[model samples]
Target: MMKLYKKYQSLIKISFFIIIFLISNNCNSQNKYEILKSKIENISQNSTDNSKSSIEIIEFLSYMCHHCTAIENILNQWQSSIPADVILIKIPICSNKKSEVLQKLYLTINEINKPYLHCELFHMFAKEKKSITHIKDLNDWLISKNINVKEFLELYNSFYIQSKSNRANQLAKLCRIKGIPTFVVGGKYTTSPAIAGDEYECTINTINYLIEKIRKE
Candidate 1:
């Protein structure tokens, strides 16, 4: 009889503990949801006054910037899947020193029909921490893929890369860009998607709201 009573007590104890555990799990999930909801609400409140802008959304990014890479890593797919009517552009951040290298790579990838190579380079540099800052490093990497190093040197110093890099630098200066992973809506107002929101979803929500606000006007 004592053994049966002890067994009953054990079962009751287990049941009580299970109920508490389930309740705690539910509370944790609810808290997480509330936190996300609050962040979305904050973004919705801080949306840009799009009634005054005329241009589309632009993402000012840099391959060497870790924060920009983080956002691009998470939001690039969602940004790409945006509709054709959505004017989304990526502008690389420029420096007097190494901006030309990025422009050359972008133009070369487009010209050579090797778009995937751009992604590979990003993965190599941003993810793999390779020394991609110098033009020679990029040339050597390209050479491994059977591209002629001389042609890369030619393109690197060509008017094509120089003019485009200059233009990119000018645009960066005009925008008063101070940091990577910045967003400019309609070319007038600048925002930080990460600072404007808590999660990637909130960041996107802010962007979509701005676009709609523009179209309604």
Candidate 2:
């Protein structure tokens, strides 16, 4: 009886270790590249036009958000390396007074084809602690940069810029964006460095994984 009881104890210990080993392996087998379906969802059906078939990458952001500012350099580097099949689009959030000013700045700067100044604007906001909330303040900043404030104001308040800003707001709503610095891939997978385990590289790779998965499908 004593020998049998000792053998049972050994069996129990062996079973426990086996269970632990299996659980560990099962977890490791789950690919990091496999993002949760709950984390990403389909926004819309893809267009049938192959010309527009390129994977659309939309960044829902706000210039006033510090997290958005932090990813600026990473975004620039990623854009330069993006494949030809990926089209990156920036949508500024204009839900408030301050964001409205930023939306105008982005659209105006883009219209003028001076994206180089994007980093400068970020620096002004994040580092220099500039307040661009007021039009006068924005005008002063533009003048300091050698940009014609009058001409900039003319374009900034133009009907074209207003329409663009309105469109951007609509796009953000469609994406169901909950926060700034959100990256939506193929109009389905929405993620960020924070969402991707606080790893910017993970966010980038997850985007690439989704793009490739879409291409295969």
* CA lDDT, every model vs. true structure: 0.61, 0.76
Candidate maximizing lDDT? 2
Q: Write the per-residue lDDT of candidate 1 for residues 81-163, one digit (tens) a residue.
A: 76555556666656646754675676656556776776676677687988566766776787788888787668767887667
lDDT of 2 by residue, 1-217 (tens): 9999999999999999999897555333113333334423333244553435577777887767788788788888988998877877787878887789898899899999998888888888889887688878887888888998889899999999999898788777766777778887776567776666656666666677777877887
TM-scores of the candidates in the order shown: 0.65, 0.76
Tell me, what's the RMSD of every candidate? 9.7, 8.7
Q: What residue pairs are clashing in model 1?
A: none
The clash count for each model shown is 0, 0
Query: What is candidate 1's local distance difference test score?
Result: 0.61
